[model samples]
Target chain A: MAAEPPYLELLESVDSFPHIDISKTPYIEDESSSFYQLLLPNDARCHGYIHPSVVHKLAWTASFQVSHSIPRTVQLLDDSDGKDTAAACSRAFYEVIEKAVDSKIYPFLKTMQWENYRIVGAKYPTVQLLRSAARLFGICSRGAHMTAYVRTNDGIKIWVGRRAAHLFTYPGKLDTTVAGGVRAEESPFECIVHEAAEEASIPADFVRANAKACGAITYVAKSSTAYGDDSSLMTPVILYNYDIELPEHIVPRPQDDEVEDFYLWDLEQVKQAMVNRAFKTNCAAVMMDFFIRHGIITDENEKDYLEILTRLHRKLPVPTSPSEA
Target chain B: MAAEPPYLELLESVDSFPHIDISKTPYIEDESSSFYQLLLPNDARCHGYIHPSVVHKLAWTASFQVSHSIPRTVQLLDDSDGKDTAAACSRAFYEVIEKAVDSKIYPFLKTMQWENYRIVGAKYPTVQLLRSAARLFGICSRGAHMTAYVRTNDGIKIWVGRRAAHLFTYPGKLDTTVAGGVRAEESPFECIVHEAAEEASIPADFVRANAKACGAITYVAKSSTAYGDDSSLMTPVILYNYDIELPEHIVPRPQDDEVEDFYLWDLEQVKQAMVNRAFKTNCAAVMMDFFIRHGIITDENEKDYLEILTRLHRKLPVPTSPSEA
Candidate 1:
């Protein structure tokens, strides 16, 4: 009989990434007694919760009332008149946040150039726009990330890269070949092509033709950006996944300084790196998801295969759309 | 802009399948005080729990020991030296059950043909095998199901079918295009191919070429098969999901009597059927999974989007694989 394929042999490893305890993480809820009542960016670890009253100071915080049914207690009302209030509050909220950053209250906000875009979610409607740095805090920002790999005679090798050391959050940690947040009005497919060109110097045409949709991963976990005595800020993220098969000769070059360097790493090396915490906290999720999907992690090797699979695909709290609301 | 897809328009309906409260279902556990102590197939609903001491009548019971960590209180031992004993016990157990079935212990089972298959799990090494009828009693079995759809110019439509009325379980209920349990030696993909041909009369070659691995759904809910004074069995299932796009020209004829008839139904019709209990309990899960994955079920339309998704993919009790055991 022919020998087992290289991918099948890789599944024999009994090692797995440390289980992530999502329950231990904080949540954004309506209850006033809940811990980590607000979200903060990774760089602004010292900033306390951006109290709803802060937005009230701008005279437009009426719609940010708490709701029991929704995970995020602070909701954006959907009534046409209430929508006007929400829109005004959003505009004022954006201005207040931008001014605070300019005043250096969130000192880490100075680290990168402002992308001049706003994030939105199904949980709430927003006309407010904030810089890229603070979008993930107290908001749902959908991002599209792609892992580019190549099929080789010996085995399948991933084109891995490292986050630049100077970056504030998870500096120098590993990342997928092409990863980026989806900006307003940008489709996931469109974002993948843009990130592919910007992050890995890959041609848009090649990525568009080769990428395969690999579903998505969702997580609500605590970040290190918590204020004192509070465990940390909790953030919710929905990452749409894709697999792009690169041609053997098309070596990836870093188009931006966001990534330090790229390397062609084997599946075992990637698996070991995941176990070693070399990858960014969330990037580790992406790698494990890919491995399990490709059947590199089986019931034979992973003690909690079912648990891991369930958590990997756990649905995050989605906002109700305006029309439906 | 192009006209809105028919599938998208179908999402306007807020109706959904009746909520399945799996947590409220009985469980089969080793603890003497456990609510549901055993599993009896659908047809044997009137027969309640089967006492293990009854197996001693055949003098083949040894390792049905109680354990703390294993799912079924009745554990299967994995000691290598005891292989012969376990094998003999397995053989005797098979014969005893067969004789009982042939003796009409389960009259409903007599309606179906017996495929020579025994269920095995990673949690314990098996020396003996039981007929397919009794596999769910105290052990875990994994099944693979496929939802095949065709792309229409008006939007995506699905090929749905009804289970034959003469079947013992869920007779005349609606079902996906094709679904089946994994045989002892067959892999999920191999089982899918076999089932596709057997149930839908789709060619083996078409299934092989078009199937896409969409992931799996896990559930461990109590079966409604209860006797006059006692509740029947509780079973756990991990169904691997697949989506195969069928070419418009090929019509599926029911090869096996398992499926009664096929229909080229629109999304709205399927959604209405789900809300009306037209599909079997588990098949409802398969359709909901398809809807959520394909983005037909949104947070706006489904008040409990997260709750529904969680229930659809609830984690099952996965036994430790034999090697690990």
Candidate 2:
């Protein structure tokens, strides 16, 4: 084991990844707004151009695709002209994307779950989204998660989950106790309660009674798309964090197959597991955030506390699409 | 009173100011970034110029005074080079400002309580700071406040304190149960504890133990400075909100002269007071945030819910002095 760093002497050594600078990533295409990219994992590049006819058919009439490079165009909507078309565009676009995923992406249909959807807007007042499947397609989706822990007499204990092997991504990796994506019109609180019931056998009523609003963690990162090609997908996510002080006896059992097993570990065990990369990368970040907020990882104990905080929040581009405005 | 507007049917009608178009405010000068302007309250103007010598003497060495129309250059630091000079500059600037406050500002400063002195940079880290007196000067200072509430049997109850009639600004205005400026090196949690003890006579230990972090409310507004002139000083504020659930029968009594009286008002009373503008403008926003977050105010019941949420969060500009890279 590596010797403890001078800053984080209060905690054990951590093997963590340095933050990637998302802002520095170039659009790579003229028509692309800094907010999103086509995420053509197959081409090994961003800024892919799509046919203008496809965009028009999808009702993204206001969005003009750059025909420069590959024939993939990004969705850059002008706020005013785009508002009326949002619902129609999302419906049309996602339908094609869904079909593409069903064929191109593997074994995603069974894991599909309904989520309140917003295909073309910044958070609020979604244009005609009843619901949509939330699974492998979430790479391009905006999402939220909740982190929960229990206060013990000695210290605090966090419950971590191991994803079932059959899961599409990060299978068998560690995850948060309760997490779910925000469905259309559902608030973070509502999502958390619903997730608590589905992921863990925890009763919805119990979660509703006990949960407390902590805040949120937001990030935009380039991620892997449908295929594990050299190309990447740029996705935006906002994790609505919650600190639940679970009762000692209320052990969470897997309600669905999303989670394999649960483990209640103290901070030390969590640190060790994190160092071993036992947790999902996103889950690790969330756990680290919880530690920093709770004072477990202070400036005295962590050298990169400031950098960590800075990395945790990304100033998302203002949504200019008429629907978002 | 006339029936509440259909928009706020759940609450009473508000005779409040219309939303100010902050984005329309022009940059004061060529050198000055749009972030800080010579706030012209009710005047259709911007780009005020100030002397370079004043900017230098004020220890804004890393910052250049924009001499367009702005009479006095405001201290807006650029991120890169200004990072290192932050501690020293904040120390120097606040020192002179403090002296100016003592000698020139006004006669009554007994209300000035010690605030952890961090004058430079936008919150988060304060390298080296001693305590400085906190008061009306907070307008020119970065401040944080905690809006604490308790869960009553019926719905929810908030602790409201009427400011003493003798206080400098907004005398006798209603305020949050526990609110104060974050002193240098004092975390929001610590400041809340200290303020709870000083303002409400709430036990520090109890506050430290029970208080929960809900989130924060941030805004940039025009404020008054030492020289009360037509050119308002643009002030930026971030209120770190907290929700504390106190056990029943644990009434909060005013411990200091800051608070005249404390009332445990339920949701209805709080909303009525908010509509009546009994609470300070900022305090009213904070309470509205609390109500909205708690689901007491929803899109179904409130017309301005989306607008309110949008107004609550403002994307502040990055602090960059001319020296910033």
Candidate 3:
């Protein structure tokens, strides 16, 4: 039998995926980088797309396959038809992916061989088709994904896990065990419950409710070797948040095959772990920041965590390194 | 060929079935008396098996079902169990529909039978099943059921209508074209949109945002006919406030089949229409009161209507010649 993976080892491995070079990409980073911020426009007309480097990094880490090569078709709209605005935005977004792929930003990135990504009917980029392969394999739309904060006697412990190596995207990367895409007809609440059961072995009722909202994240990257083509859109993730309080008697058991192990840490411990590079998962870091701001985790420890995040972000690898130029 | 039926004539003749005497039944009343100054409870658990007499008065006047004939074994908490407490609250509400074949209430006022009366599902006593029905009927739930105050060139026209006569209950009585039940799976916003479309034929885009949450009203009644059989519960109504700006060219058109006629009533006209002894609709009176309290209708004519309502409520129906008890 394979030995159980250590928490930090799994987290670091997930974060080590190659990122796209963004040094030359003109983009503005905002203070409110929460998932909800993804919906707000970073500039005029269009919200800023993620740098190709970041997309490449996410694709590398996630192990998503790239399938197609298409020409870049970015169109700047001064003023156009309101009815076609969503479609226009999506077309422009697709063009950015084309550019990223053509640039060959990350040679090692794999392509999403499955035709999972399609234009969301009527709603443009806000909606997408569920890939049959993912559906058959039980990988659902990201809209159904939920982040649950479980409070234990030891403090608040959230269950995060690394994706399996065989998975197409985010392989070996840390992610919420209970987060994934919701199916076409499924409710967000129902989807989260199903995810919790499948990923963390936690009962649906274990989730507590407080503030809830929907958000999205977009990024561009080169196609992976898994794809027959060279150019493809990288990873675009949408996430929803729900706060749940579980009974003390409920114990979490991560799926043995899908997840390597589990850890129960207090908020302070989790914060320290995040700063110490003990929890290197990008999603985990984002969720921790959310928890601290929402008063779910409040203390002097939050100040320290924030400082660490700021410093780490500064030193984090950029898509275009000085050596590359 | 049959001549096209006149709207009012068709509505009046639709539910010509004889009325059932519900007063003798074992039923629960939400309040002690209609004249009593008591507020309806908001909690779903506060329901009681009511006297059929109260059911008849409340349900008929309110234009909804008053039967205690539905199966009782179904659990109310099934949908809510282990989910959020709010989901529990929403799912915990259920009414016992007395199963009486060939009963007057059954054919004329207990089930949704007429297409015009179909506000996307059975429009009897609750928003839950009604909302589900809305989805089944393919109506846009978010734009149909809720009321909107549209600003026309003539001023703000509050659209109102009488329930279709062939409806299971509340036949021929005035009802809001929008406000209705929130489904088990739907939010308040969704319910109103469907209601608006079905009842008033209002287009979806016409509805404005920034809805003022006006709260809710619940009424229960016991069957007087089958005293030991079952009781009726009616929480058929939910209220919301929305404002829409209309272009001058857009003339309000009431769905001839669902509404008796379109009334572009100003504040004074609305007030006068509400208390006109001949108006004879409970829902209209309630809506008028709502508008008045919210200061939507402020004019001398409204004061006259209020005076009329006060006088009408104060005087009980007088027994003539000692023949009536």
Candidate 4:
């Protein structure tokens, strides 16, 4: 049998690959493209499809910043797709990565590496093929993705990063570190494991729990700062809640090329920071609520973050439409 | 375009033709034929890939005894396949029927005729094709050949029948009515609907809700008083809860050819009956519990049934056999 062409190899050879800028990557119009439109909850819209490289950039630039940015992006994504699709995408992403890692295309890589190298990096043919397959499956055919939540003694932390500045959407803003689109062949459990390792530098063995599935959300972006198009659509996403305990001393070092900085925040500080708008991204606001709800973080400061999250939670209505405004 | 081979003609012929006595039909399990085993939620085994006629027989018989016997069979079928698959099958079946009816295969059909005829008499090409497709797709599949469930005014009801004197497996004893080996291209929903119409003459529309998948269970049924062959195995069923409200004056009339008699009981009565040894099929006992937990039924009589269901639920161990135990 002839050896299959190495699609991943071809992708890795590129220099200055197109990356999604976490800050610049505008929320994707729900209808911009099926890719962006499909990964959200029903009440949310497509915030954007950040290039894999951008995720790595944010993780490396400032790990702590990711705490805020990633959650915000997720919220944006959820808002664009609607609540149902967002949750579905979340669950689906987690599951796909967990499965991809199990297949072992990239081993022992940190979450950031996994994102750019394995998922966004387009190093594996399976990932790319799965993306195409997902598109063909139509909205109803899409499977749930995966999401992981990790906490260490360094402080209550979530995996996040910034999109490469050069990318089309949200360039330089923080975003999910260990998150990625789910492949057709994998389950939520499989996707998250791969994403966690690839994006956050978390090892597969470090994962301790697979919690209940949080709901889904959707988001849709209008013609704006990025993508410069009128196309608007919804993206569906499923979210899963996972609990992981890390050594208090363990400092998550974002892959420098993919991330700009990393930070470890005390649960209270992070929560207070979110309330105080100390963080630049909505990702932080969203994740703070996730942590508090899951009981991963409990402090008076958390109350503020919790309140913001609750408001956002309520703000993102089910079956929402543009006309609702 | 040679007239589409009379697709509608074929369907009508099949429906109008005199019913076949599948009970007496000589059927030889095709050992050479490939089969798929799906794992369900209870300690019951469901054999998939049997002939469609057999499936009809099981469903029809079960539906006739909707009040008592059908529930048992549904329980056994549910136990055979995971809840997700079961639910998927139910949804798929309804969709196919809806589509077929929309296409107007049989015109001038009254609402009741539409529901009843479509439920029992509808032929599903997609479900028939699923067995092979599932394998190609790497999905674990199973067959719940002899089972059926109904939605009653009060809540979901499963039906089982006391097998006739001249039958195979569990002859002259209580068994599922609308269930049997699920054939290729037939989803659980279609299978049950078909069975219900044939056995109970119930309109499909009256079955407002479809099966609620709880999960699968596997058990071994050694040849006993029901069967002369010691080597033969029996795969009972587990089923989901569905609701179908009927006029207060309407009474379920079982087909004399298929069932000895039929009666309606509240959830508690059914549960109590099972616990007090008022019923013969273990499958029925288990289904009652599934109904209770899903909030399909509540009250003291149902509570007693739930207790028996709980006890039975605990007694059945995982099947020991590797293939179709």
Highest TM-score model number:
2
After superposition on all CA atoms, how large is the RMSD of candidate 1? 9.2
The DockQ-derived docking category for candidate 3 is: incorrect
> In terms of DockQ, which candidate is strongest?
1
Q: Summarize candidate 4's per-residue lDDT along A1-325 as a digit string, tens digits.
A: 2232221222122111122222333443322221221223333333234322222322221111222232233221222243444234434444544554455432322122222111211111122223322211122112222233345545346544555565333456555444454554554446657666665666666642422233221211121212322222222222323334455554445543445555554445444544543332334433543443443432222222211222222211111222221
Q: State in Å the error of residue A59, model 2.
A: 14
Give the Å error, residue B237, model 3: 42
DockQ of each: 0.16, 0.07, 0.01, 0.01
- Candidate 1 accuracy as lDDT: 0.57
Give the TM-score of chain A in candidate 3.
0.46
lDDT of each: 0.57, 0.53, 0.35, 0.34
Name the regions of candidate 3 deviating beyond 4 angstroms.
A1-153, A162-174, A182-190, A204-237, A276-280, A293-325, B1-325
Top lDDT hit: 1
**Alpha carbon deviation, residue A130, candidate 4 (Å):** 8.1
Q: Which residue pairs clash within candidate 1?
A: A122-A319, A123-A319, B30-B73, B90-B128, B122-B321, B122-B322
Cα DockQ of the candidate 2 complex:
0.07
Q: What fnat does each of the candidate structures reach? A: 0.08, 0.00, 0.00, 0.00
- Return the TM-score for each candidate structure: 0.62, 0.66, 0.29, 0.27
Model 2 CA deviation exceeding 4 Å by range = A1-91, A98-116, A120-140, A144-148, A183-194, A208-215, A225-232, A241-249, A288-315, A318-325, B1-116, B120-144, B185-190, B208-217, B224-227, B285-325
